[model samples]
Target: MRKYIITGLLVWLPLAITIWVLLWVLGIIDGVFVWLLSAVQAVLPDSARASIRELHNIPGLGVLVLVAALMLTGMFVANMFGQWWFRQWDRLLFKIPIVKSIYSSVKQVSDTLFSSSGNAFREAVLVPYPHPQSWTIAFVTGKPAGEVGDQLATLSGAASEEHVSLYVPTTPNPTSGFFLMMPRSQLRPLAMSVDEALKYIISMGVVAPASDALSAHPAKQPAAAESARN
Candidate 1:
């Protein structure tokens, strides 16, 4: 009985937490839809209520309807008319003082992260951080570009430096992390897969293994040294 209990916990613990988190998010979104539907019902006329009221008939279905509506709206904005309208809308948004700063910052990050051509989160790399010889797992967020690249060249003393932005995520919570920029030569590419590296970090060093090949490998000696200068 004791052996079986340990096995059961090992099997079900991850699944239970995963399901619990997902359901919690879904419940919150569902509540938002219910509130919106209620508001619509109050302002809507008797005849017009038929359309929105149909949404309330299906249990936990209003959120699905809202999601579909949002997708369709996005598709419409992706068209030609949407392009012109979006620019006008953005111009208006920038006129607002406090809102403009927050909106613009978020927009820039979203564009960089979601752009098809961007190189964010492409690889797992090892970097010396906090101290020399101390290593940490980091994701290559992107290569510095534009004015940022120009500035890095002066700071790093390389006219054409390879500066990469990395996200050094903390343990257990990968969503929040430290952002850093370092020369590419300083970053050592890790042989481990990203998923394995993430698991190692989330476990807070309790679940990592020594890399024999990586630790043992050394630079090859020059072949000319063997032949001698004679």
Candidate 2:
């Protein structure tokens, strides 16, 4: 019973934290979203005002704004001038002792998880979740591409297997979760189809996949690992 409670905590706590962090980031973006709406109303020509008003009245505007911001940021960085300015800005942050630690760490991680390339979210895997003592399911999103791949290699002593980008989905709702990247060697590969993994995860281990693949391997009982000792 004690172990069950502990495991349950391990599962739900990370999900809660991931959700809280997501909401926090969205909250910040939402503020910007609102500000942009007001700016659009104030600055646009009379002919554009009605469309701006319509946009302001609609739902999910914040999500749209957030998407637009990311798209614009990506577009900016892709150009040569934008790339030059980005490097300068990046270097300036790196020069700051405390800021560099946070900035670079976030940059490397974001690059690995979010960089657009390769086949993202193609496979399901099992790994220690929240901590190594417990386990959960994740999807193989993609690998680090281009310069991000180089950065990952430099982190290790020598050239090594590329880190696999992953999306660790939450229980009950498989959509929202954490993004991760770890060495391919460290992963405990699972044979379960990605769809099967999603069903198992969404059910919180209640609806197991109708396959003996997981059961046949006693040692690699990843689905069972999320059972919280039942």
Q: Which stretches of candidate 2 lie over 4 Å from their true place?
A: 1-29, 35-59, 116-188, 193-199, 210-230
Clashes of each: 0, 2
Instruction: Identify the leading candidate in terms of TM-score.
Output: 1
lDDT of 1 by residue, 76-147 (tens): 889999888989999999999999999999999898778888777767888899677799999998877799
In candidate 1 the C-alpha lDDT for residue 194 amounts to 64
Colliding residue pairs in candidate 1:
none
Residue by residue across 93-161, what tens digits does model 2's lDDT show? 999999999999999757755666535555678877788799888888777778978888889553766
The CA-based lDDT of model 2 is what? 0.80
TM-score of each: 0.79, 0.44
Off by over 4 Å in 1: 47-54, 191-196, 205-230
As a whole number from 0 to 100, the lDDT of residue 125 in candidate 2 is: 85
